[model samples]
Target: MRTLKAGALYFVLVFGAGFVLGSIRVPFLVPRLGARFAELLEMPVMLAVVFMAARYVIRRYALADRRTRLLMGTIALVLLASAELLLAFLMTGASPSAYVASRDPVSGSAFLAMLVLFAVLPALLPSGAVSDNPFKPKSVGGSDSFKR
Candidate 1:
């Protein structure tokens, strides 16, 4: 249940951010930078959002372990990807293969790297580094609330 809740939050935040970036990318950036470059430009912004979202989820949930946090983030990314694909089909009526083939190799590879980073960011930091649990105060002995 905790994982589900955290994953949902991550998914919502990331997807919302993506929608805003996509809006800009499609019209403003794409025309000037072309589809691939526009996507690459959006990558850094989305990656920033992913880090913020991951931290938010970790702090909000007081996630205990790197494993659980990683799992939650991965689940969120999977859901976000699924949602994006669905939206693409609905908006453009493109089949999956066509959609995949439409991607510029460079931008697509960068996007995939970002997705992997999204899943791993939560675990990259030690557990207590991102959490503030009022109920589970840190001990002076250097024991972390997440150690359990």
Candidate 2:
């Protein structure tokens, strides 16, 4: 349930952001910078949103473990990627391979790197400094409830 909640929240944040960013990119950036650079520009925005949203979910839901955070983040990424590809196909009527091949080399590589970082960040960023259990009161020793 917690994973689902976090995943849903992540999806909402990323997808909502993509919608807004896409509006800007398609009209303004794409023409000037081309499709690749426009997408590269959007990468940072998406990463920032993902970082903030994941942290918010972690703190708000008290998701302490790396596993849970990773799971939620992965689920979010899969959904985001799927939606993005689907949108590309529908909007341009381009086959997946054709679309991939069309990406500018530099920007395409950068985007791939960003995707890797997105998968790794959630697990790496969150520290297990807090406990998820509500009944166990936090002690001076921190996450180790028995230490006190």
Candidate 3:
């Protein structure tokens, strides 16, 4: 249940960002730079969103175990892909096969790689240090190791 909630939230966050970015990219960037360049330019921003969204979901949901994180990521990936295909069909009247075939090859390949990254990122990110002050370094051996 927790994993499901986390995964759904993750999907919403990343997909929402993509929707907004795509709105901008399609109208503004595509005309100016062309499809492939516009999509390439958008990739870094989407990557940042994916990283932050994955980290936030994992932490918010207390997804500590590797298996749980992996499951959550998998769920989000499936949802994201479905949503993309549905959106393409609705907006362009393209069948799933047509949509896939119409994608710019270079940008489409990059998008596929991003999808893989999005799926694995939750499990890949570190959970962070167990400290209130995350910047404070831990002593090597003993609590007094830093003292005079």
Candidate closest to the true structure, highest TM-score:
3
TM-score of 2: 0.78
Return the candidate ranking by TM-score, descending.
Answer: 3, 1, 2
Per-prediction TM-score to the true structure, in the order listed: 0.85, 0.78, 0.87
Over 1-148, each residue of candidate 2 has an lDDT whose tens digit, in order, gives 9887887787778688879998989999999988877888789888898777666677667877889888887887787778878888999988888888887898889877876676667688738533465346556656576655
For model 3, how does the per-residue alpha-carbon lDDT over 41-132 read when each residue is reduced to its tens digit? 99999999998898778767777787788899999999999999999999999999999999999999999999999999888877561234
Choose 2 or 3, whichever is better by lDDT: 3
Q: All models: lDDT?
A: 0.85, 0.78, 0.90
Q: Is candidate 2 or candidate 3 better by TM-score?
A: 3
lDDT of 2 at 35: 87
Clashing pairs in 3: none
Measured over all alpha carbons after superposition, the RMSD of each candidate to the real structure, in angstroms, is 4.9, 4.7, 3.2
> lDDT, candidate 1, residue 131?
48
Instruction: For residues 1-148, write the lDDT of model 1, one tens digit per residue.
Output: 9998999899999999999889878989898979988898788889889888887788888887989988898889889889878998999998878888888899988988888888788888666655476446667757474586
